[model samples]
Target: MSKKVTGNAFDAKIFKRLMGFAARYKWQFIVSTISAILMSIVSVAKPILLQKIVMIYFENKDKEGLLNYSLLMILFLLAEVILQFLFIYIVNWMGQHIIKDIRIQLQKHMLQFKMSYFDNSSVGKLVTRLVSDTETIAQFFGQGLFMIISDLLKMFVVAIVMLWMNWKLAFIAFIILPILIYATKLFQIAIKSAFQEVRIQVANLNGFVQERVTGMNIVQLFNREKIEYENFIKINNKHKKAHVRTVWYYSIFFPIAEILSSIAVGLLVWYGSLDIVNEGITDAGQIIAFIMMSQMLFRPLRQIADKFNTLQMGMVAGDRVFEVLDTHSQIDKTGKVEAKDFKGNIAFKNVHFSYIEGEEVLKGISFNVNAGETVAIVGATGAGKSTIINLINRFYEINEGEICVDNQNIKQYTLKSLRKKIAVVLQDVFLFSDSIFNNIILSNETITLDEVKNAAKEIGIHEFIMSLPNNYHYNVKERGAMLSSGQRQLIAFLRAYVSKPSILILDEATSSIDSYSEKLIQQATDKITRHQTSIIIAHRLTTVKKADKIIVMDKGRIVEQGSHLELLHKNGYYKNLYDMQFASEVA
Candidate 1:
């Protein structure tokens, strides 16, 4: 992905995109804004009320007037607290709702992306976009946007009150304002760069951890633990350094802001004392009120810097997320034809394809499978065996081809309906962390537990399932880690069988299993493929001997294709492969 040239904390384009999520909860935001304004007004009134009570009622020994003024102050303070609560609650509510909607839309968009996108993208990075990045956008709404507005309002109101009370004192109090603003601007620029680095490191760390943990078994088997640990430490330290840089910026900024705030207060006292002694223009009550107002003004100046950081981080996150949302790699499913009446007749005419440009995996390969025909494709590694099945499912668009089903172009069929009628069982079967029943039926209401049990019986894996402690309700754990490879393959078979697909494609389905499991899988395969158009890709010649037709592929082209007996009699590529395998087994 290309780097986004972000402007500032108030980057209008990025912030506007973020507010699109907020606009959905405009009423709540409006309420929160009103609450913030009310709090600001109440806060501004309290200090002025203090000045009045001190200058008039307390100084005159007017007990009744002082009591009434104190009561009014108490009421306004109470109102301030209530409004603050509402502002916080409503802002956070809006933030959560906005993030929920964003996360849902982000995931929905990713789900529509083609398999080619996933092939080139990092799963961990995508996951971070869905979870951590979206949470940062939430912070924009909950803490950054509204709180900045409220703080600015409070400062603006305080400035007006201070100027109205004593213009000369207000001028003295604001002596440090320009310096503070300059410091804030510098802090914003420094921290923006630091925060961008921090987010990049965070994504890198997440990707590293996810990949290493997922492949832990391979690392351990290859004895790469020490090397991998050293690499992880390096990534973790980079992540730590990125965060420490941000903290360093905060450390420098907050202390400077505090010193400026103190200087402003000291300036007020020093200048006000001079005005009172030399000119008698200001009194003790007005000076005290000016002190309070200065704090109100400068403190928000300090806080606005922090809130601005929050807003900046949120924009950075939004930029990354919007990149995913804006990706247009989704496979087109706008075909007018539905697969409701699919006949399972598939053909690939002069099909040419490549994952990367100019490196064709399948070079103008042409073949056809008539209705209910069982065709097995055999090839060495990287000969485009799996690519064919992927193409048939429309996981990746072909570079140049006419893939047709029942004399109609496959591209003319809606993807969902087309895929629903076809089922694929890959060599590496993946099961969710759910019960075996859910894994088989995939939470489909149409297939019941009893139906799954019946399908398991039909595939001869019913006894194996019943042998487990929880029977069909047993959780398979992540990727079916709790089960043996053969057992997982058995579940895959059962899943495909339950779908009742018009076309079944099994890619090396029984190649990695033991003889016992292979026997069971063969029986299941025979039952499932009976009278159904099945495409099987396998390396084991024994498995495909029973196939109706076997096609031998070499270097992205078919070397020979015929029935098992016919190919053997011809002594071509298929015969050579079968003879080599049979001899190796005998030896």
Candidate 2:
């Protein structure tokens, strides 16, 4: 989760990419930029107007001229304020819009990634990239990029005016500038590193907390509450230290900048007073204008240093976000063929797969199922039963061989088309935090409530559903936590059956349930699996006794295949499994 800061203090490539998100709002960006320029120009004008009011009006005893010029100075102040407000508002507005677009694109991209990409990545870290990192990039525009530009513009205009008014005094005032600039450069580099570490710590803390909260039940069940608390304290401490490092740089850099700024003002007054007394070339008004401009020049330079850190932090976040965007882990979707009027015939040819290199979960195994056939795959834990389901769904890429549905290679059909023809009921059924009706339909407008009710009636779950308060309209809550395990399984069966998939897979669908729920599920299963191409995976051999054919597996390889009686006669792996399960049931 802790990514290294390989980039420089400022990466031009990342900056340009971030700007591309603003293409739709170019007019607003232009207005903000123009306002910054105008604000700088107006800011420089006020100091000049003040100098004129002192020298031309007050010096000559012209009260009316002094009052008029003072009003003009007030008018310029008002214009500057208006421009500053416009600059701040527009830049922030654009920032929020840009980040909204980025987050949308990031989420859409993640949705397309292969399951293996998620298998190897952290959920909490992805959440940080999608939410926290994108927010930091928003500040890149609001506080970093445009604010730095505006401050630098003010400094530039003030510098030109200072020199134009009186070059000798301007040179004297600029004597300490080089030292401040050097100090600022050092601060930028140091703070950039510190901010990168801070971001890493934030991601780590988020990951730790998210995992802990999600698994709080497991922690409480195992009496790990105190241990988890201590672990949290350790991660929280690292987060604090990372932030304190950033503060450390701020504490050192700011006071040094203030000292240098005070020195610049002191030099301007010392030389200006000597000039007025010795040669009568400088007046009180000129000295006062130079002092104001000196503050203007030094203040923005210091502020620019601070803003540059914000810019650096944005770049760090941008780099992490773009790294995800740049990944080429999405499943290939170039297949143009549609699986219309699909047949239930399925075949696997010399298939081989490994979740990790050199450790195959499925060897070069091959099998075939005729249309409308019902087959069962029985295996011990880690025998690649679930991996076969994943492969059939194209959730991952195969390392070797091909899978064919309806006698055509699955790769020849679009992923959407291929998956649309198949339905799966997982052991751990996942229902959204929504009404039961919506969860069953899953946003498919084509399936009406009448159809869902009909499917439930045929599956024998209609009475069970109607018994609940609000019936089908009841909210299941997150992951269907409001319902029992058996209840969730019943919902999944209805969902898959209503889809009318050509191929149906029930992986351990009847395991770990009460007898009442199992009886209901068996009734539902008989209705859905009848005359449909169905593959069942179960540890319960008794459930597969009626399967037309059963494949027994151990340690990622098939050891036997036949009907229950045929395997029992052979006295092989399947018979031993059936005997052991029957003995356990009797006990």
Candidate 3:
């Protein structure tokens, strides 16, 4: 869930950090800023030129002077147009380049985070941070900061000119200024809250839609379409309300600004006419210039309020993005040892672990597997069978205990080097939406097509793959949905075999396949595990009977460890489990 933004609408620290991304393109940023200032200075020249033409040329009927000043005003207008274009183009270019760098850095950081971080984080919210929030930050440069600076500069220059021309009329013009400024301040505060709510609703709406679409199959199977639709309606309604609240603020603020601007103009005209008649203090040309200056000053004051909201939204987005970047969930990769020629010997000594703090998942368990030995673990659900597989790979840090490989602590080896020596084929296989060959090689470039075909042939699934539409080039679609479950399992076996890892783990690899695929998997299994250290976690008792040794677990502890025949004869936990399966098969 997103936290509410508190304190000031403008966060200086976050703004500075966001600007740091622009340091690489400092030249472009500087050019844009200079262009914006030039544009503002150019904007003030038109009113001053009008005042000069009216005062000097109109009274004297100097046609040459009038023509010269008119031409000069045209030149300034053209210069302002060119400066405006440069300012917009350069700032937007800088924004795009900065966001690109930030996105790359953010993704790289996220890739190194620990698995536990992902286990608790929402995928949709992470997507929001990566895609939408970063885009908003980009607007901070393109539309918010530079534009506001230009508007404020224009207002400042116009205000100074107004006071210099006629002090009394300028004072009348600014009488309504304080009221407008206070109202703008109130509107900014109110709209900032509204924009924050809008952002939150957008994230919620994204998260809900993503989850529902990914689980559409389950929704259809369970007849939950109507219920889910109703839930979606509720979320969508809240999103609408949040946006309407922002619109409501806009609707109220702009009209008040327009009315106040009109009142400032009216006050200027009344005071200037009275001063001209009673004291002959001001002329028509000065009054006209002051009126123009009043508009120039108040226009940006109104626009600044709008631009300030844009700035505020960007700050909100920056806060959310930095929150993700600031997370300290990365795995420690300080181990310097490289497992160049890792042996497959493994040991677990009194290991303790838990996903949650208070509840223990693997409690004080000890086990060992000799080099090049094939071991099978059999147990019911939640018996810590798969947790052992996760521990060996260092997916999660253990609470208390030592896991050693090759008589040295696994922590001594770099994570990349250690994982490279181990290959896992899980029960629920996942394949990318790509060709069979690419999925097998996983874009490694080091593994050739010939190598993959040879591995498939060694696993005895080459002929099966050849029968597919495109052979090794067949596209499996997302999650291998185009292939049968058994076919996916065969592909997984080939993938693991091609890696040539020192240790191979098959967790229920044959659990849900047909008899033909199971036979093929068994042949592949025997071929691959013959000279490799392998761990097989299976529910089928028949598959483990020929294993060199079987470890039976119950509730996170090793209840029995022996050969299949020895455990069957002992009439222990393994005996009861084997008899129950045998009875079910006979019935």
**Candidate 1: regions farther than 4 A off:** 1-7, 200-208, 218-239, 585-587
Quantify all predictions' global Cα lDDT against the true fold.
0.88, 0.88, 0.87
Q: State the displacement of the C-alpha of residue 515, model 1, in Å, after optimal TM-score superposition.
A: 1.7
- Residue range 15-114, candidate 1, lDDT tens digits: 8888888887878978998898889899999888888899776469888888999999999999998999999999999989999999999989999998
Per-candidate clashes come to 0, 0, 0
Local error of candidate 1 at 477, Å? 1.6
Cα lDDT of model 3 by residue, 427-462, tens digit:
999999999999998888999999998888877889
Q: Which candidate is the best by TM-score?
A: 1
- lDDT, residue 364, model 2: 81
Model 3: residue 267 alpha-carbon error in angstroms: 2.9
* Candidate 3 lDDT score at position 280: 72
Candidate 2 per-residue lDDT over residues 287-311, each given as its tens digit? 8899888889988888786688788
Local lDDT at 327 for model 1: 95
